[model samples]
Target: MYKAHFGLREQPFGITPDTSFFFACPSYQEALNTLLIAVRNGEGFIKITGEVGVGKTLLCRKFMTTLGDEFVTAYIPNPFLEPRALMFALADELEVSLEKDVDQHQLLKSINHRLLVLARAGKRVVLCLDEAQAMPLDTLEALRLLTNLETEKRKLLQIVMFGQPELNHKLQQEAIRQLNQRITFHYHLGPLNKDDMEFYVSHRLSIAGYTGGRLFGSSAIQAMYASSGGVPRLVNILSHKALMLAYGEGKHEITARHVRAAARDTGAARNKIWFLGWLAAAALITVGTSIGWAYFK
Candidate 1:
């Protein structure tokens, strides 16, 4: 809504995992590089773990987008399925034809055939599973089995799992130890640090065609860092709200007050001191007024 007012072609703080708006902060860059290097090395299973709203999905989308033509990429955004259903999802992504009511064995055979064909054609097939912690145990084991289909040199189907930190706990399960062991390159994506957050917000704004002075002031940036804990998604949310409030109030610059108000409205930052101080001062003012009235009477 404020895009025109902000002089931008699009909303800068959108929550969508748009690869175009991706900010290459240090941690995310490292994670992407780690995935690229590991996959190039024919690593059977590469895993990225991060907390919710830490931009794992965004990083995954960017990686797949930039992965280029040498690889055939299949993305499974939601992996909460039975072994048979999981196979169907992968098949659908790979464009492997499936007849109606095909049994599990037949489906697996078709997938294996497709993987082999891609391998022969000098194409690397990568299966990227997002939200992988929700994947069924049997399905994860099935994925491990798929990795077994390999030439003498490298594995046929490379797997990259992007998931919440729960995925690590899932990996620790004894049942999926083989899959866990196969994860040679692992990157845990954490929130951006304070300095990174400053750049991240500005970088996103610049990408969205923001031209002019810095929209977010330094104190406002500090408040953003404090409130968002440097999480990109949270920063986007808080910053977007602050922008709307600023625009509504006829302000061009985003101040710390604007950020705090946004935080209060958003149930983020949760600065009890602000509220508590307001309450305490109100109590004192009320008492003083009452005493003055009594003396006047």
Candidate 2:
């Protein structure tokens, strides 16, 4: 609705994990590089943990896109199935055909054969599981056992897990200690800093076809950083709402007032009294400066 108003071709702050909107901040870039290196090295098990809305899914998608034709990738976005179902899903992703009468052992054999074929063909096979923290304990163990299918030189199928912080806790369980020991690489995604947040917002907006100069002023950006705590998803939500507020007011640039209004409306402004007080102070200073400039001129 506000695209035309803001001269943007599309919504800049959608919550979807769009790789095109990815901002390669220092932390995110490092995480990507680590994943690439770990996967390329045939690391048997890799884990990336991040808080909710910290761009974990985006990073995961970016990794998949970058791997491209170099690797055969199976992405399991939801891994909450039972052990057998999980294996079936992986088999389906790998294009391992199984008849309706096929049982779990038959499915595993098919998958293992496919992995060995891919390995012999000099192709790296990667299984990326998202939301892995929700996976049942037995399912996780089943996955670890699958990693045992390896050649003398390297593991046949590399596994990459992206999940919330709870995934780490789950891995610490005594029953899953074997899987934990196999994790050759691990990274914890942190929130973006204030500067990164500013760049991230501007980058997404520019990609969405915003050619005009800064639409969100410094104060608004600061407010956004505070409100969102530098979390990408929260930043998207607040920035989108702020843009809508600005468009509704027929304003070309988003001011602190618009940000505050959006924050209040979204119930994200934690320090409401402080934010309103600053707004009042800024308004007074603007009015006073305007009067003095007019009188002097």
Candidate 3:
């Protein structure tokens, strides 16, 4: 809604995991670099963990998109499947046709054959799983079996798991320790710092076609850093609502007041959580009344 007033080409703060809007702050760059290195070395399994809204999904998409021609990537956005379902998902991703009555043993054999064919063609296959913390315990064990398909020198499949902090606890279980031990590269994707948060906002605005200088005031940036604690997704949520407040006021720049009002209306800062969900009903009413009064007056 504020794009026209701000001369932006699109919404700068959408929550979708769009790789095109990726802002390579230090943590994101480091995580991406680590994943790339791990894949290149043919690591059997790699893990990237972060708190919610820290941009793991976006990083995963960007990593897959940027892979070189020698790589073939399969993305599994959902990880709550059973071991059999997991195998079927992989087989589907690899374009391995399956008969209606094919059992688990036959299915796995089909997948192994596909991996070998791709390896012979000089292409490395990488499987990426998002929300891996929810994967069934048995299914995780199944993944270790899949990784065992290898040539003499390297693994046939490289796996990368993107999950929240709970994935670490899940990996610690006795049944899954083998899979955990196979993780040769691991990185914790943390939130942004103040400087990176500010830079992130500017970078996204510029990408959205905003040529207007300094759309967010220094005080506004300070408020955002405090309210969002340098999380990219929270920053986007707050900045977006604050911009709407400013737009309603016919103002061109954001201020601390706008940030506070936006925080009160957002479930993120209001509930002491990171960016998530919509504002509570009462908070919504209050902010709506306040914004209406200010705008109309």
| Cα RMSD to the true fold for all candidates | 7.3, 10.5, 9.0
After superposing candidate 1, which stretches have Cα over 4 Å from the reference?
A: 268-297
Q: Can you write out model 2's per-residue Cα lDDT over 1-297, one digit (the tens) per residue? A: 999988999999999999999899999999999999999888999999999999999999999999957699999999999999999899989999888989878889999999989887889999999999999999999999999998889989999999999999999999999999999999999999999999999999999999998898999999888778899988998999888888888989988788777777775465766788899999999999999999999
Query: Model 1, range 1-297, lDDT digits (tens) per residue?
Result: 888888988888999899998888778899999999999999999999999889999999999998879999999999999888888998999999988999888998999899889988999999999999898888999889989988888888999999998899988999989889989999999999999999999998999999989899999999888788988899999999999999998888999999988888875455555777899999999999999999999
Model 2, residue 60: C-alpha shift (Å): 0.5
Alpha-carbon TM-score of each model against the true structure: 0.89, 0.89, 0.91
Summed backbone clashes in each candidate are 0, 0, 0
RMSD of candidate 3 to the true fold? 9.0
The per-residue C-alpha lDDT of model 3 at residue 183 equals: 94
In terms of TM-score, the best-performing candidate is 3
lDDT of 3 at 166: 97
lDDT of 3 by residue, 45-123 (tens): 9999999999999999999998999999998999899999899899999999889999878998899999999999999
Candidate 2's clash total is 0
